[model samples]
Target: MPAGDSWLFEMKYDGYRAQAAIAGDQVRLYSRGGHDWTRQFGFVAPALATITKGTALIDGEICAIDQHGRSNFSLLKTSLDGRSPIVFFAFDLLEQNGEDVARLPQAERKARLEALLTDLPADSPVIYSQHVAGNGQQVFDAMKAGGFEGVIAKAPAARYYGGDRSTAWLKIKAVQRQEFVVIGWRPPEYGVDNVRGLFLATYEDGQLVFRGAVGTGFTDKMRREVHEVLQLILADGPLDVKGMPRAEARACRWVEPRLLAEVEYTEVTPDGLIRHPSFKGLREDKPARDVHLEVQDA
Candidate 1:
């Protein structure tokens, strides 16, 4: 994170990036890729609709918060089964009252967003994503101690550039984590109908490249569910990945790289492999082709 009073730091959330479009009595929730997911996260609409009677557009994250008030990505899937509650943490106000606010500065947008959600009931699912101005190191230290994901430093004067990555926003992760495309898998040696590990890869310079396998961090149920999906999408030939070890290439049961998995790792090896990797869960909001090696800003 850059050290400056002009930078606004917000807690990086571990959840799906979503937008809420509220028009009169109608509220639609869209994914990061603009796919409508209102029905999937139905509980969000009522709380957001209560925010205004006119039209508004809000950018935020849909997260499953644990008992410690931490956003837990693993609980997101189980929440869909009605096991836990999910909420929307609105961070930016794109449009409000039929007025375009995308070009506004970060500070202005956040102020407007907070004001919009301030009147909501205490039990409301719509939340205002709070941020602290400056103190990059202090904020990072506090968040890391609290077991938070990371911090997003935003240029206070920067305007929101929808659908584009901007230099104005920088992310500093307390833990190294990102999404990877599942290229294939290794079947369990001793068990029937179980996967031993997942073969992962990411896009580099327009080509898919091998990243090594993640052998741990799977529950018995996850192994079963993932195995069922892998069976259906088996590829006729191996993926045209670069730098795959010969032994792994021979052992892999290649599959279409359409499945995306979120994984955490200790660090990236000099040879371009993730070390001490742990699987978090599968992510559907992002496409597999968009998965790439994320390098944090220094």
Candidate 2:
């Protein structure tokens, strides 16, 4: 590949997408789909306001880094709840001084964002997302070697599209894992000893849609424990299944949508089902409404 001024790269943090918006003295922090999370985050919006003189909107992620200095999702909620240190990795400046900067080139926007956050306390939660020019393959290889999630590639000239995925900003992951709602289950096979597996789904537009079954990565003890929980929430049938391909649908028992699960998958199928999905564990910190899916590019 030819080296040029067109490409930029950033770290792919495994955390919650957050947007900090400030108007006058009022500030707000939002989760994906515009969910208000300001009160929970505590000081994110206010800190950003202190740096910028006027109204501003900052797009970023709320992450808790492990001892290795890499973002770790498993520690995010607990770290936040305990009022421990967290990092607000601000990547994009959407607006400043009531002026929209979404149309600005990526490099120009990042430069301005860097200048806005020139001085911050060493331990401040708010951090300006840093990027490197070119050397994507080398950086990605280093990420894999360092056991990092992945790296993101961006078109320096591309304009920002808030809350939307675009080719201009591409992400490639070395590991695949995310939270999903356990909507149902499949009982043990006629002669099988333990429960078969659980039916998992993710929300799209706040609507729960079936993803697939996760039967692997569970210990015998966990299988039995999860089975007991599903039994308690057993329901007549899937509550709001819009559709499912007959071939993919098997003998499964539908349960209420309450339990959340963290799953690891090799990829997301064309039909939006998770491929090679393995049950990591229960996601006690995440709510069912926050479950979602993203199919990686082939």
Candidate 3:
């Protein structure tokens, strides 16, 4: 098929991005960053071995679905405690049989992928990632209502542009929400400045962006707990701002943004600033840098 400008869009799954390579009877799973996670997902190796033809390269997410039909990352992480079955939602077929399909138009590749999955067991871990024909906005809205992370839009005929954040593939995230390590605090001016607001920071593109501080949405009890946590990490020095911290009328006291807290915000401004963010709660699982902004779409 001749490649065109038409693109095929798919749901931006909210799990780990993985590439499954099936050659003969052997299967190897590689993370997007090129790490081998096959041993971590040992339960999926056999499922992948079912591919009977030549080498096949599949790109998708390794997610665990709960009884409620929702993707649960926390469950996956806990269950695996380093060993669990992982369902691979295959979204794209980069190679099949003995042919390399990465250079083919997306529509053709998708058709081939659909045909390949049609005869698989109904409840197989390997399933297709369905796409909307032309209603991108509808899919986007549906994802939001369902609490999904986001949607990716791809040119129907665009070839695979590996490791490139090309405009050809666009991502539209539902909302920017993550748990960040509260390395420091900025006190509100008025009454008891036990800990007015929190300093938020996450790593992105290898650079740290202080996503501004959040003071709203804190209960008195939550404030006390946060104050205790910040007290231990307290250091006597001005907060480090590779870039100047944007301050509002709210008087502030700076601390090391070292503790982790869950936060939800509307979006990231063009200059990498977060807008209208509010504190959610404390998160103990994730590290500081791992809390960075993620582009949900392509």
Candidate 4:
């Protein structure tokens, strides 16, 4: 369905997807994969506790904001390990008073989530993720102009899908960058020299899928550094990612899918290859198995 009066749009922050659950004096924070990262993002639980009294499950993103107020992806680890500025932007209320309200409509759930954080102190680590209902095109235009990542649109009447990706919740990006598992790398060639290109893949519907290669955007120094790491992780084959191009597969020197990289692209071709993809950097913090592609409808 097209975005309009029936949809809710919010800024899609670039950060760690997390869920914070608070019950009385106890609080816990979990990654999207269920890892307990409370020690890492230590400020989330306490701040959530100060405002939310009853047992509640809140869905949000833990992010570091820059001088321009945009979420900074590269600083996420710094926020966890150093004294960087960070905040947990809560956008949905999944449970309350020991009751699961995940099946509630999006608007109602968000309304309750806002009420739960109405009194959160400015210094608190938890901040409410604000949104505008409808007018999504306007938001997208603004995000593109401001160099913001994208806007997410959620069906106002849709139910939350726990630990699952759903089409009801969609993201429209101003920039196209995705994390890929580095299964292999081509040795430095080009008249210049370093690592040449990277063979990439991602998880889709819980299955590993080949996403083809990215050869551009690497500086000589970056190639040298990553080539060094690739030497240590060499393997006999790429993970069982299906649909790899025959020629690419024949040429690949496989490595373990233990590395992740961020890639900027123009679009995904119909056959699933990245169009004009360029390397952004290594995503040392993200796990290979957790990297997934956003499936676009035909």
Whole-model lDDT values for every prediction: 0.89, 0.77, 0.69, 0.80
Which candidate number maximizes lDDT? 1
What ranges in model 3 sit over 4 Å off? 1-7, 81-85, 177-207, 212-241, 244-264, 269-271, 275-298
Worst 10 residues of 1 by lDDT: 162-171
What tens digits encode model 3's per-residue C-alpha lDDT throughout 184-284?
77664666646788777776665556667788878887788778777777767655554544453123455555567767788878876678988767654
Clash pairs (backbone) in predicted model 4 = none
TM-score of each: 0.95, 0.76, 0.66, 0.83
Candidate 4, residue 113: CA error in Å? 0.7
Best by TM-score: 1
TM-score of 3: 0.66
Model 2 lDDT tens row, 150-188: 887888988997533577887777788777888777777
What is candidate 2's CA lDDT for residue 123?
70
* Residue 218 displacement (Å), model 4: 5.5
Off by over 4 Å in 4: 81-83, 187-197, 204-207, 215-238, 243-253, 281-292, 296-298
Question: At residue 254, what lDDT does model 4 achieve?
Answer: 84
* CA error at residue 86 for candidate 2, angstroms: 1.4
- Backbone clash tally (model 3): 17
What lDDT is obtained when candidate 1 is compared to the true structure?
0.89
